[model samples]
Target: MKINPPRQAQEWSYSSHQESIGEALSSPGIRSNKKTHINCGSSARMAGNVCANVDQIRRQGRWNNTTINDAYLTNLPRELVRSMAGFPTYCRFFYLARAILNPPTSLCKKLFPAIGE
Candidate 1:
């Protein structure tokens, strides 16, 4: 004898406070990219505290007018990408081997132009 109950599909419901997935994953520091900030509690619940991308960091770096060359940061580790706005953790051998080999000399020039010359 079958003792299991039949499964039923439930209707999907959306709350007015719920935000889109893109909005949920977007970082607040990337405002210069023209993304609107969703001011609701659901975004955190939907995306948790760890959502970031390299392209987002590149845009933010350019927006902030940072001296670091974009080429060096393309393959940055996920953690570094997330903290590009703040202080980045320095683990060059493991995380930034490629960038280290090809350093951001432009950044050095911007910081110490006299030495660069």
Candidate 2:
């Protein structure tokens, strides 16, 4: 123990107001990329406690569930989703012939400078 010095104590933090998830979502600053602060009310709900904001450390809450698609997949094109109901037989054959004559592959590739490989 001689080699290791005693732990230095730091000042404690405390807060006394409560906040709701809706209130946080309503705040304009929060988007898919915005950082959020969540306070979990445990078995013992302490009074006057403050919600802490952890910047680098990751945390999630109710707002996470509100989105149908995961963040990574959200950026993908809408066409990636196939038609729920199949197209009419005649139309499908027509498109198939047209695709053979002029393939749509060229239309699918686009380069966005911001998102570089």
Candidate 3:
């Protein structure tokens, strides 16, 4: 089987919500509370929840705007593309190709590496 490489590296940035969560977590006096916040959900938590949705969408091929080709190959950064290309064909095809073709939202990318992979 022939394997094609991704054209570019997928780049994503942290949402404001995510930044807030990191700030909360990394704050000096904040206690480590494992419980999910009842009122204001943390950015990391929200991101994790959204990632689950993205994975479901990808596996089922249910994203409204996503095309088959989009799910197969992503436009990752040059460095990432090179790294992915070094992996086995099937891995590259499924991970890089599917990710690019599907192109997850920024939230999904931050929450789930698998979704962005």
Candidate 4:
């Protein structure tokens, strides 16, 4: 399917080099041992939801950090990843998503005062 171009075009920077997915992932600094830590704020933590201590959990290797090595994308489809990466890197789409999640009344209001208003 052909995607409609945005009214304002976005420019994407191209990296000089490209390599296989495996090579790209393991090419140093790309791999990570830290698992994803999503903080749902103090309210959620106090309500006994989500982990409060990411380090503690990771130390035990139970819910520890995850490494973003080549094998990390083993389950994810390559085509999907490529498709997402291929899309124009417009940042407006991201702002729309952020506004939906947190609304402008919070931090976004202050951070993006002119735009949020």
Between candidates 1 and 4, name the one with more favorable lDDT: 1
Could you say which candidate leads in lDDT?
A: 3
Q: For residues 3-95, could you state the per-residue lDDT of candidate 2 as single tens digits?
A: 222346843232211223334545755443222223332201121112222211113323232232232113333222223233232222224
Candidate 4 lDDT (Cα, 0 to 1): 0.36
Q: Count clashing residue pairs per candidate.
A: 0, 4, 18, 3
| Per-residue alpha-carbon lDDT of candidate 4 for residues 46-67, written as tens digits (9 for 90 to 100) | 3222323444433333332353
**In candidate 1, what are the lDDT values of residues 45-75, reduced to their tens digit?**
2222234343454454443324223222333
Let me know the TM-score candidate 3 reaches against the reference structure.
Answer: 0.18
TM-score of 1: 0.15
lDDT of 3 by residue, 78-99 (tens): 3455456653322223344444
Ranked candidates (lDDT, high to low): 3, 1, 4, 2
Using all chains and alpha carbons, the TM-scores for the candidates as numbered come to 0.15, 0.15, 0.18, 0.15
Tell me, by TM-score, which candidate is best.
3
Question: Candidate 3, which segments miss by more than 4 Å at Cα?
Answer: 1-25, 28-74, 77-84, 92-117
| Residue 24 miss distance in model 2 (angstroms) | 36
Worst 10 residues of 2 by lDDT: 42-51
Model 1 poorest ten-residue lDDT run: 39-48
